[model samples]
Target: MSKIQHFAFLLVEEFSHLAFSCAVEPLRIANLVSGRTLYDWSFGSENGATATCSNGSVTLVHYGFDAIPKCQQLFALSGIHMRNHVSKPLLAALRRERARGTRIGALCSGAWVLAEAGFLKGMQAAIHWEYHDSFMEGFPEVNLVRSVFVADEKHMTASGGTATADLMLHLIERDHGYDLAVAVADQMVYNAVRNATAEQKVSLQSRNGMRNRHLARAIQMMHDHVSDPISPALIAEDIGISTRQLERLFGKYLNTSPKKYSMEMRLERARNLLIQTESSVTDVALSCGFDSPGHFSRVYKAAFNVTPMLQRGRID
Candidate 1:
């Protein structure tokens, strides 16, 4: 038998319990199915003994930041409020681990932590989609992708939730063999296992159950230009369709017009920015294409029944 490989997880405050389970269970199943000591794992936290997840559940740890044992790999796991929890000690621990030549990775918003430690400056990484906006704004040097996970990089990353399982299964296949990985996945009854190249979410076309290429192109254009939105006529013209046809497409499928849908998209981005970043209300409004904060506030209240300031305030 090959030597047993050890994995250590550094659980940050407010880590995702779902991601934690997905990351560790596959290894356990692999050992059970293989009937050998193929892998071993342990947990670490900022403090020595315990870490808490976002769902308010506590997890015991085998080590702390100051004394993470030697391991083949280490993964940092985090979730909401990830930025706030990135302390100096955690950064120091990650840097120390990397200096010791341990392969490092992240799960969920934990990429933000690794980025903070300067380990992912030019690495292609994945973080949960909800964090895409603020993460891009914060870590422009990191090549963030929309995939469920990125495994080929020196530092692997999973976008969190079940994507962590996809990554773990992939590692199992790499370390052992495809048959054992399949057996482990079967043991878990996870039929729709995705690869690293698979995107985290279904495409808009799939989500809305439509295959309209023109509609997809238009929506992509809108998403790509949320900060500096263009008119519906321009979108239609760019997509080689008439503005009337564009309006008709939206009306038939989304039950809204292009203008309304675009406005809603911008408002949604504005709301995310308010909750996820430290941008002022005026800054968030401008970032989402509004010129005047007062106009933005009125439209925001009309749409969500609360002002942008209040939205940010609610998070505290």
Candidate 2:
């Protein structure tokens, strides 16, 4: 049998409950399925106060940063306005653990904190898709990938949700065996388990409920050019499809026009920036490809029923 592994999850305020639950539960089931104490886990907070998640749920920690114990590994779990929660103290604690030879990793947007501490310089990391734009803009030294997770690349990083479960399963498989990992997954009823290299979101074929490669490529292009968005016609041409065919593809599966999808994508990015950064509404508008604040305001208000100004300070 492999040695028992101890893990610590350091929770930042506004962390994702889904990510946290998915992370801890997989380990629990690994023990249950294996019928051995294969893993142990604990939670910590930056302050003694309970860490509140993005969904407004609270989790009591075993201790604060001052009390984090030596473990086989540690993962920082955070989401939403993660920029607000990262502190020098937390970074120092993580660095101390790394120096002691603990494997450090991140769940969800926690990569932002690691990058802030210079732990991710020149390392390929993954954050939740929502944070990709701001993270790249802020930390140019970190190589950010769109994968759901990256395992054991100096430091592991998972984009969160079920991706956390996948990472834990990968560890279980490596340390224990593939059969044990499959047993743990069976207990969780989590079929279709993904590997670390899988992309963050559901595959477009399954998610869009279709198998149109052209449509998928077109939408991916839209996501890639949030700020400097290309027209739907350009995307279609790039994908080797006529504009009309692309429009039909979008209409059939997404129930929206390509232009509308692109607009919503840009608006969603705008919202993320406004919440996660101190950028002014004008800057957010420009960064999201709006020609002017006035145009962005009108579009934003139409879609979300509130002006960009009102949404600027809102988190999550």
Candidate 3:
């Protein structure tokens, strides 16, 4: 019989409880269905005791970084504000474990930690979209993908949330077999097992309201033309509506003025470019449709409470 694959989860503060649960429950259910311990897992924290999750819940840890036991795989689990949590000791321990040949993976924003430890250089990684901008800025040498999960060579990374479940299911299939993995998914009532190519966030249509096709088209246009935004009047003309009618539609459905919404969209794109690309501030500003770098700086600072230089520096 094959030996059970030992797994250790390194949990950080504000870790996503949903992601952690999704990652572990599949293994537990797989073992139950297989009638043997195909997988063994434990949790570890920085302090060897307990760590609080983002949702105000706490999970007990079986060990600390210093006491991490031998394991076939180690997955770091973290969430919001991940950049602020990495310490010298944690980075050293992760590097040491990697040197020792323990296959390491990350869940959600845990990729941020891995990247900070300099483990993801030149490797494909996935992180939550909310942190995509900052992560890109911080890990310029790493290859970032928009997929829900990335499993390349030896490293595994997930964009977190339900993606964790899908990754765990993939692991189960690799270990037990496809049939068993399907059974586990059925037991959990997971209708669809998302593959790595799946997107992390919901589609714009589903997120914005199902019936508003005009709003959907408007949003799509905004996304497409972030670099050269169309005027609200032009957008209204293209969508075949009067400017007043468009304003009414936005007011009723989106609760924001069309101009404000367009600015926000441009600013969001600028933020992504500021962090993801090595483009100069002037280039980024012009790319995002801001006529002047000074104007872009003012708007960016107003939106994110930091200058573009400082934001980029933080990632560095």
Candidate 4:
């Protein structure tokens, strides 16, 4: 039998409980299915013997940042407000682990911590899609993809949630054999496992529960041009359909007009920027294709029932 591989996870404050379970359970299942000690795992935190997740569940850890032990691989796991939790001690511990030649990875917003430590610069990485806008604005040096996971880089990353399970299954296959990985996945009743190339977001077509190619193309166009929204006529023309037909498609499938749908898309992006990034309101307005901050504020209030400034203030 191959020698056992050891893994350690440094759980950040308010980490995702779902991602935590997904990351560790596959390893446990792999050992059970193979009837061998294929892998072992431990947890560490910045302080104390327990770390709390975003859902208020507390987990016991084997070490703190001050006492991280040697392990074959170390992954940083985090969730919302991850930026606030990237402490000096955490960076120092990661740097020390790197100096010791340990393999490193991240899950969810944990990429923010590694990027802040200057390890993800000039490397291709993945983070949860909710953080895409803020992460790009913060770490332009890092080539961030929308993939569910990235395992080819020196530092691996999973885009949080069940994507961590996909990454774990991939690693199991890589370290042992494909048969064992399949068995582990079967044991978990996870049949729809995605590869690393799979994107983090479900397609608009899937989410809308429709199969109209033209509508899908139009929705994709709106998403791609959130910062410079085009008219519905232009989108219809680009998608090789008449404006009337485009309206009909939207009315039939989404029960909304094309123009209104596009506006909602831009507004949603604006809300994400308002909460996730430190960009000014005017900047956020302009970035989401609004010509004036006053108009943006009025429209935002209509849609979300709060002004941009007040929304941001509430979060702060």
Candidate 5:
């Protein structure tokens, strides 16, 4: 029998419950399927206080930052507004764990905390797609990729949600064997498992159920040109579809016009940059391809109900 490997998780305030459950459940299933104590885990918190999840659920911890127990691996689990939980003491604790040669990783937005601690500098990592722009802008040195998870990197990163389960399964496969990973996955009844290389974004086909080649091509073009947005007419012409047909496709599937979709995409990136990076509002506006800052602000306010200026102070 292989030795029991202990894993510890440090939960931040407002951690995503789904990510946390996904991270731990795989190990539990691995043990159940293997019929052995192949894995063990415990939770930790910054303080001795209970950690609250994003969904308002509370988790009790076996340890605190003051005394992070020795373990084979440790993961930092966080979610939205991850920066608010980052602090010098937390970074120092992670450093101590690393100094002791403990393998460390993150689930979901926890990579943000890892990057903030300088642990993931110069390494490839996966963060949830929503934060990709902000993470890139904030941590320029960190090689962020659009994937469900990154397992082989020095520090593993799961983009969060079910991706955490995929990462845990990958780790089980690496440590034990493919059979054990598959068994664990089967026990969990988790089909449709995705590997690290899978793109994090939902494909247009899967999201909209629109298999129209023209629509796919048009959407791809929009994604490719967010920073230098092109006109809907140009997109329609290039994709060999009439502008009217293009609008109908979007309206039928996405319930929005092409112009609205494109604008929403750009605004989403702009919001991410505003909250995740130090870029000025004008720079963010330009990067998102808004010619006029006033126009960008109006659109942004209308979409988010908050002005870019107000969002600027949100970066941690």
Candidate 6:
């Protein structure tokens, strides 16, 4: 028989209850169907005892950071405000655990903690789409992918919500078999088992809730040419709108000016590239549409308040 895989889920404040349930339920059903405990799991928290999830539900944690159990895998589960919750002690504990050869993983914004703990250096990771911008600003060295999840060697990360279920199912398949993983999914009525290449969030059509073809094309142009971005005036011209009109449209709809939004979008892409790619800082700057590395550095430092070299060191 294969050895059981013990998983320790480290819960954080405002954790994603849905992701937690999605991760654990599959393991539970797997054992129930196979009539064996192929997966053993427990919960832990920094403070010990209980943690309130984003939905206002409370989960009782069985262990604290100081008393973490011997487990094959440790996944930190978190949701909103992950940056605010990361303390020096928590990062130190994670670093200590990692030094002991314990495999580390994260779900949702939990990647933020892993990044802060200096564990995601030169590692490909995934975070929820909503926080992708903030995460890039916070940890520029870690390679951030748009995929639903990334599993490399002993490390695993998922872009929370239902993606957590897919990640756990992948683990189950690795431990048990594909048939067992499928059975667990069937039991859970989970139709979508997103692969590693699958994106974390829905398409722009769903996100924008708009059917305007010109706006869609403009947005696509911006996304496609993130590194060499076109000017807002150019985008307006292509979409047959005056620059002033375009600014008004974006301000009315997106609550921001077109130029500012485009700059933000480019910076966001730059942040992701910095974390996910090994390109030189100059290369990263050029790729992100910044003609001068000095300018890029100034803006990047203003946004993240850290030099790119230091950020890279944190991830490496």
lDDT of 2 by residue, 102-128 (tens): 889999999998998789999999888
Worst 10 residues of 5 by lDDT: 201-210
Cα TM-score of candidate 6? 0.67
Q: What is the Å distance of residue 123 in model 3 from its true position?
A: 1.2
Candidate 2, clashing residue pairs? none
Pick the winner on TM-score between candidates 4 and 5: 4
Off by over 4 Å in 1: 202-217, 220-235, 238-316
CA lDDT of each prediction against the hidden true structure = 0.86, 0.83, 0.81, 0.86, 0.84, 0.79
Predicted candidate 6 versus true structure: per-residue lDDT over 111-219, tens digit per residue = 8898887788778889887776566667778777767888753578999999999898888887778788888988988755755655554576754423556666667
Residue-level lDDT of model 3, residues 20-78, one tens digit each, is 99999999999898888899999988888999999999899899888889999999999
* Error of model 4, residue 268, in angstroms: 25
Give the higher-lDDT candidate: 5 or 6.
Answer: 5
- Please state every model's RMSD to the true fold in angstroms: 16.9, 16.9, 15.5, 16.9, 16.5, 12.8
Report lDDT (Cα) of residue 96, candidate 4: 96
The worst-scoring run of ten residues by lDDT in candidate 3 lies at 201-210
Candidate 3 vs candidate 5: the TM-score winner is 5
In candidate 3 the C-alpha lDDT for residue 74 amounts to 94
Q: Name the lDDT value of residue 14 in candidate 3.
A: 92
**Colliding pairs, model 5:** none
Candidate 1 lDDT trough over 10 residues, lowest sum: 201-210
Model 3 residue 234 distance off true place after TM-score fit, in angstroms: 14
Candidate 2's TM-score: 0.66
lDDT of 1 by residue, 213-265 (tens): 89888989999989899999999999999999999887655546889878877
Tens-place lDDT digits, model 4, residues 1-316? 4989899999999999999999999999998988899899999998859999999999999989978888999999999999989999999999999999999999988888899999999998988877766787788898887678889999999999999999999899889877888888889888667667555556674543346789888988998899899999999899899999999987655546889888877887787788778999999999999999999999988876678998763311
Q: Kindly report which residue stretches of model 3 are placed more than 4 angstroms away from their true locations once superposed.
A: 203-316
Sum up the clashes in candidate 3: 0
Candidate 2, run of 10 with poorest lDDT: 201-210
How much RMSD separates candidate 3 from the native structure?
A: 15.5
Estimated TM-score for each candidate: 0.68, 0.66, 0.66, 0.68, 0.67, 0.67
